[model samples]
Target: MATEAKRQKVDDGSESLQDFLQWCDRVGLVLSSKVYVSKEGTAADYGMLAKDSIEEGEVLFTIPRSALLHQGTTKVSSLLEKEKLSLESSSGWVPLLLALLYEYTPSQSHWKPYLSLWSDFKALDHPMFWSKEERVKLLRGTGIPEAVDTDLSNIQREYKDVVLPFMIRHPDLWNPNTHTLDLYTQLVAFVMAYSFQEPQDEEDDEEDEEDEEEKAPNPPMMVPMADMLNHVSNHNANLEFTPESLKMVCVRHIHKGEEVFNTYGQMANCQLLHMYGFTEPYQSNSNDTADIPVINLYKAATQGVQSDSDRRLIEERWELLCQMTQDKGAFVFSKQGCLTDSELHTALKVFCMSEEEFSEFKDNEGWEDDDDEDDERISQALSSEGLLELKPSWKQLIHEAARLTLRSYGDGEEEEKVVDSDRVLMEDRAAFKGLSCRQRRALQVRFGQKMILNRLMELTKL
Candidate 1:
């Protein structure tokens, strides 16, 4: 929603727009003339805007099933079906990427005009496209680098085993020079940035129910013009799917010339940057989250040099705590990166349980048939007032663990610098000039996590 310059109008007479409209008409798609694709000032290069005032619930466009580009609708489906290519073992994106690759070739695709309007690969700033050195500098301490590496490995394997073999089998259709690994990476990025996982229809859900196995829903799909809408944390429009078509509808009233924004659900800055190459400031995003790696605490608790008996006791206590919490994996901070009282209570209980108490709970399988005394004690211990009963040593351990996790994000000097800044200036200057977008977004996530950890550590003091 930040605008730094005047909106530039795209030429209505442009050949690509004309061709896209003609193609839509040929495919029985209905686009309202009231909306047009145009510059979105500083938000994005292209976004759809209302040419006239639109009311809530009004349909902006409807894309028929025939116009969707997916495994089932693309022309390559027939060829893949002929080859008996079983996508059962492949990830959801595999078949979709193959379908996209097929459609991208010369003259064989009916969706070329629509595809021509896609954003350039060079312009994309998703972390997957970042240089190795950039990633090290910007995302070294974060989980994003590991995720990026995993994605790259999976795509490489898919290309080597599935896509490359299929291309080799059909050399006449796929020229080697045109189907390079670089193109595959770009297409994967394109799919990640634009694809949507549509919900299945009622009939399909019924069929899945009858089938007993209840397989996952079909792969995500590429919807051409619908992908052009820019995202805002508080969006005014959303996509509605029916058996016959996919419709984009105004979810709220819009004045004339206002950009039609679409919601991408509640995502954190890390997720938004990882997928869409953009980040919203903390003030604008109501659903921001930060992840605290509790696994690090588990490791720290178990791996220290200790007497054999002491180490065994610690491991048993840790295992019992994991069972009690159902190993919730990570301590997730929500609501603008602050944990709720209940969440803090849960963390405190998990971190502070004594070995004898854990053994008693384990013996009872969490109070399944608890005697009155045990039941009374646990009920009091887990109550809101029970937080006051935590031992001083347990509180110190929790405080130390929280501090260690925060320190893992950076060296001592950098952590001190981030903690010293006024929170307002940190948020306002997140996009500091001269920093690459990836670096800025990474900094925002790191800063948010440190702030949340600081608050959690303060609670331990209480």
Candidate 2:
């Protein structure tokens, strides 16, 4: 309670997306009141819809721990001193940017809680905060600057006009309490694990350079969220290591008026966005050539099919299923939260298609002209009142990955199969479409021999 008498506070609070939807309908998490706009929804990022059919992989919005501040230590003068927080009106520097998110979390196992944010800002009792000509301008703003140094751009324009607009005119940054987005999502996951941490972690390890001089920890800024998930690149949200809080049952179903997408680049297209800076917002939209199947598990650890810890567990479960389908805005593949009991039936017969291979293709004698086209397809899957079930093990793995792309052979001039499904290749549309109802049932359960006439031409063309 060191208020120094509420130092001219600011909270009348009204930023209202109807009080962020009456605090997300008093916290049950369902948001989709049909609000899509780009021309003027006023951009601090917004997009919504599903007034009706959203079945595929359902859950579209979530962030709880009573909407976040989970702290441990972030001492830049205590985000000016915690004053004990929580939404009964969060106080001052939003508890010092959520005590810089107790320094590294998603539930930290590494970066040792950012070394207690550099030993609590070098045990600050303000030992002249930073004078030795400001430690030679913080050791010349510790490199990575090249073209700007009017004394490190006047100390980062005096930390963005007098310390980040006095920590963005505090009053809990604004809103009865915004938890400054759990302190800007721990400063955007400490800026995407900050250029992948360690170069002897850029200084501050002293056992005795005359001992006391520590305060360096505030660098955290890598802005990815899967490069703000817009612009699809043949996505299935497999940013893979399977972390849906240690999976239990959703290999694929995700419907409810779909937008769910993920695949930053190459388990074939956009190739994990070339290792992840991501970019598609219709850069002149068109397929832009993406057959994308680049499987080098380095050759499943020199062609043994698995082990170098199962090829680093298939490259850390395909980069955490493309960063959990770009932070769960859409792509929703669920290995039942992920594997068990005989490795979850061998990862469900290796990622999906077996009701005993559909009764051994309905006992084939060329079964009465495929039983008059499976009786005009069970009367149009009972006149479309809920029927898109193709999972016979992801249709025998997308027709054995599309007949191993009609017999692989890179550096080509040999791809003219007598059937050209209009082969456009790129600028965007040719194969991938709005697909999601759990990615057309994991492409008919892994490719049910080209999804039974591509599921009767996408249910007689939608």
Candidate 3:
């Protein structure tokens, strides 16, 4: 009976998908015969698939501008326009959210077929929907918990301060019972996960500089068929915007029966899991990065400095850094697990100088070229590799900082070291399969960070 029920569900889904495609055609959405939508196994429920071999540079589909769903194109646009100030003041996404809320509430909507594609709210995986306990348990050190909390707080505030007031005024158009916070939150998740920001036209850049500056950037739009293609780090297709329509074109050849992948820009694992509720396997996302906070470095520098005078000197040096530039953001490790940040290196150099040397350095306002020999030597030493050749104190500082950062991860348990060997990585990838989806994605995010931290420690020979 269970097997029969599963088959029935699949059949219903297939029919719904067909209806959506027919609706797309009626709305002038042009799809190439060589490409169609199909199941992508576990990577996603449905994705664009190659029905036959597709060549590079081939246009797979084109979506008419009228077919795109946003505040401008929705049937309730004029009604929402009356509340434009209220919507714009609350959030950039509010206009579209209101449109979607009203359109999705009624039994009949112009976007009924397109909206059906996203009917399964239960299937959403964005970390924002996860319980606070689940987020803490699975994603404690992944940086997603803080982001999820911020989004939740914003959603609650907007619903109370903006949405509730708008609904209360339009009692005849919208029922509070139907347009509840739960439904609004679901639509917000859809916007976060599925919407795409329309790129500004190049011609817009030539407009009066003052007028362009006054204009707000384009809001996110729900682009049907385009959003159906699942994302991968190294994807085979990209979306191209034209004056009249949006087109999906193949960037590389796709073989028959292969899934046609599109990229969501070069996002890291943490971002992928936070926004989309999924992540590429470990080591697969090329744009991955990890941040080590500046406070960690400061803590490391002050660890053994017992003199109150020295602590004051350290604080003054930090103030000088702040004066030079306001970028106190975290130092990041690149995809190759290397720290090539010049500001961080400069901070270390400033922090390492003795009191007298620091006074001279500050008097010079950070290294003038008045002494040619001294300037030449300093120039050579400031090269990328030279910057990495740290003093003993700087080396120890980095080592301690990385260790402290790792300790911030779950339960202070040491992360398993990942060797730079395919054999070890394959073993790890195989092991990833036994974990639940949430656990596996969480591990991918945290492990990616741990790998970078471990690599940094190795480079410094700690």
Candidate 4:
């Protein structure tokens, strides 16, 4: 396994790391002599390493805006704009994907050296590329299966509806045979894996206070050399944007031989695996989360309330929750097993309320505005005992739901196949090492979730 990882990393460092470094210089990307890219035997295969001891807040590298590959700088930018094709957060990453496709021809592309750093589609580990059986066998209960299906459906529609027509209209721009769905999908994976969303303008900080849902995000761009750093849950470096350039700055001191780690945000293991094709093992992801679907919670909450009138009452209570909190969907639990979602707690309290209690609660139109402080006080008061002190019935329902959710991952025997922690991996290396990369990652994702759910069970234990 280690040998395969090394080989793949070497293959990905095409044209050699030195050539890519020279390319970075030619394109106005400045790399601090303190750090350089190398073949890291870690999950990323290739990662930036500290060449010398670096102090906190030190700039590791700076990439000029001109060096970025996006719709604005691509060779087809003007043509795309002229054709009235604009990409935004809503329309998916088609714009950048298209630009990548257009610039992928080595002879024509100015980014030849830069482009050579990437491996072919075979090297990609995103679940979108997983076999159907593999996905079913390993990722049955996770959101990945549904997410991958939705992505494939959308990609096909995007290809047939938008991409094909655009390419067909301009035959010289792209070849149908060469820019096939397979290649388009590969570009999609690249965009997902490598693209960086342009930082929001600092001048718009005040305006950003508006609901984020109402805002259209800046287009994703490809930043050469910036995407090489590997990610860890507790990262020591961050990417900071300035008017002139995007800078990678160390947040803490990095000693020589230490990998210069950057964060991919406070993401859960599931999200990391889904987007980047790898996850931090042994529940080490600080931002790891597991979701218990609202429907599952509802099923658990209404397990014994079989009468039509009682069911109606429960349905009405759920409606009330939606109206009051706008929180439908799932109850998200953090890595520590604490329920991070207050809305879910409120929902549980509402459901567990007696008929008269619910009447009084509804008549009061939920808790008063000032109740937030009281809720906080109550939460603090309960923290000494447990995260949240739920009523016996409420705890029962949530515990049952947590069990059901865990069971959905598969049987206990199957769950035992994957290592759950770093210590365990060390103790039983063969259990984890024998599995395929995809299988190992799949287990990591599910097991990370299972760990979270187990914590949830503990939190709500009756």
The candidate that wins on lDDT is 3
Per-model C-alpha RMSD: 5.1, 26.0, 5.3, 3.5
Over 4 Å off in model 4, which ranges? 1-14, 40-43, 85-89, 208-213, 322-328, 337-340, 360-385, 411-427
- Tens digits of per-residue lDDT for model 2 on 72-103? 22323344444343311211233333344433
lDDT of 1 by residue, 418-451 (tens): 4554244455554354565555577666666666
Question: Which is the winner by lDDT between candidate 3 and candidate 4?
Answer: 3
Q: What does the lDDT read for residue 220 in candidate 4?
A: 79
Query: Each prediction's TM-score against the native?
Result: 0.82, 0.20, 0.86, 0.89
Shift in Å, residue 121, candidate 2? 28
Looking at model 3, the pairs that clash are none
lDDT of 3 by residue, 344-437 (tens): 6677777788888888989989865554435445444434354367677777777777777766774755543332322253367566556676
**Whose TM-score is greatest here?**
4
User: How many steric overlaps are in each model, in order?
Assistant: 0, 82, 0, 0
The lDDT of model 4 is: 0.74
Between candidates 2 and 4, the one scoring higher on lDDT is 4
Q: How close is candidate 3 to the true structure, as a TM-score?
A: 0.86
Question: For model 1, how big is the CA root-mean-square deviation?
Answer: 5.1
How close to the true structure is residue 151 of candidate 2, measured as C-alpha lDDT? Answer: 30
